[model samples]
Target: MADRIVVAGVPVDTRHWIGGRRVASVETFTDHSPVDGQPIGEIARGGPAEAVAAVAAARDAFPAWAATPRAERARILHAIADGVDKRVEELAIVETTDNGALLRSHRRGVMPRVAHNFRFFADWLLRLDHDDFETRGHTNHVSWDPAGPCVLITPWNAPLMLATWKVAPALAAGNTVVLKPAEWSPLTASLLADIAAEAGLPAGVLNVVQGYGAEVGDALTSHPDVRRISFTGSVPTARRIAASAAANLTPLSLELGGKSPLLVFADADLELAVELAVEQYDNAGQVCLAGTRLLVEESVASEFTRRFVEKAAALTQGDPRDEGTDIGPNIHPRQLEKIDGFVQRALGAGARAVIGGRRKGGQYYEPTLLTHVA
Candidate 1:
């Protein structure tokens, strides 16, 4: 068995990547592997002051970067995508370790998509054309321009992918960015900073601040210099960020959490529905769009539940690094506890656990199914 995993050619001890350098903070925090609760590494603990510094760096870099021709920006973004492709395996392992996601999923699915995000944005930006319309004997030119010195706040679950979703577009659009990755999963983002630097991206074009939302996040959102704010997280936190953005009248894009429900009609294909439910339960149902609630037509409900439980029970739960493992540990102990509490409450309300319901040792929770839950 592997005792410990090291991020190849990357520092295990994560630090803020600001102005194209590894930055240290006055304080630091420990990052534990959710798989076994082992200390993986320590990361710099940034706060308001660090946020201010990152914003300043991005603000200073914005003018030169934005002035660079769009084609040139596209070239740099393509190079970044190449770098990501080269390091996909290493990045996959790093992300799996940091976020308790399956290595197989990261390697085969997420990493490729992340690389595509950069390349896609790069190509899209290159082909972009402005429109000119003649109206009332006058010409009106319409073009999409960079929003200067933007802030991107990504969540812990699928950290690198989501960060790239925001970062690639911002860079393609000619914006300098200050990214704040959730403290829980800073490893991959740090690696991404390194990759971007290696790809010859200009200094200060992309900066990452590693810390909690209350400190660094608040600072970034409210900073007067940060003209745009994009965030993906819980609803309450989104509200807080919205309020902060309001102070500067910053344009904002928010992707908040949702408990998506899957509906099954009598005419629906039972096999396909079961497959979809099984897919939903992947990632331990921790996804923001996870289909946690299921509503089925009465005629098909009983049969559907039976097959779903059988399929869910068959899913393997073990070390995420293992190829055969389907379900990995929850991101942390608190998440495990939260899942358990929710299950317990449903049971108290007279719900029946048709298959798995309790926590399976460590941070693992069994693939669970509850019926008669209102």
Candidate 2:
């Protein structure tokens, strides 16, 4: 098992970044690549102790960070964005290896968006649209204030990009953030911590704790010092965090997974409809916002399904590093099994598979399309 991967001449750091320093954990977990189920490195297995330390750090740093001028904060954010842009290729490769997404998509789309998240929010912060009015010759003003010590819990599917979506705004608003990236895909988050530190971000202004949601997540959300909680993941986990945060009355923002459908009208262009249907397989169908179900007008359903299946069948699944590979392995064996279970149950219920209905090998699942349902 490799301790860490060297990407673009840098040995990836896998330790927790707390108080602007790398902190080691007594207990650690082995991070495995979704591409081949191979061990990529050993990551610090943070728990309540680490979570408490991180929150304390954020709380200690909150006053100074919140008091920092908006202009200065924006400058630091822009610097962070510059760092991210410079390391896009490295981050993209690390993310693709850690989470098993398409390398090309990460390089061309997701990683760039990660940097953009910081840059856009930084500029927006300087352009505050505070409401002001004059009443009876007296001036009244409403302005936004920083909420201190925010906790951000991001999902494994698109770890860095989604984490930054929450991190950027919270930091831009002059709040200190403690980010807990999903245990399954933690490499890029660690990388981001390094980037922010190098960009001159104040110590403890941004901290990262890497561990399972059940352990570290519970600790961070439940901590009283945390003023806000932002999470992106499943509904059940969101519920747990909400319950934990209720004691402190901490403000919460939750982005949970929901079933999405693609509706195709009879008049829709056949080619475009088929293209949209095939897109459901993007990210190996792991995306929470993916259109998992298709509702097509019966008049063109047969032709649409035919083209969709043909396209799905033609997708090449292999190692994510390969430029020719379209689809990559599922993030883990358990997720692969879960997908197969869904397809098997559908087939058992009389749904007929038009394209794929079985596992190919290892962590790869067939891009299945089923019809003739009840």
Candidate number achieving the greatest lDDT relative to the actual structure:
2
How many steric clashes between backbone atoms does each model show? 0, 0
- Candidate 1 yields a Cα-based lDDT of 0.89
lDDT minimum window of 10 residues, candidate 1: 1-10
lDDT values, one for every candidate: 0.89, 0.90
Q: Could you tell me the lDDT of residue 41 within candidate 1?
A: 74
Q: For residues 37-100, could you state the per-residue lDDT of candidate 1 as single tens digits?
A: 8878767889998999899999999999999998899899889999999988889988888889
Off by over 4 Å in 1: 1-5, 8-10
Instruction: Give the per-residue lDDT of model 2 (tens digit) for 95-200.
Output: 8888999989999999989989999999999898867899999999988899899999999999999999999999999999999998889999989998999999
Residue 27 alpha-carbon offset, candidate 1, angstroms: 0.8
Let me know the TM-score candidate 1 reaches against the reference structure: 0.96
- Residue 119 of model 1: what lDDT? 94
Q: What are the per-model C-alpha RMSD values against the true structure?
A: 2.7, 1.6
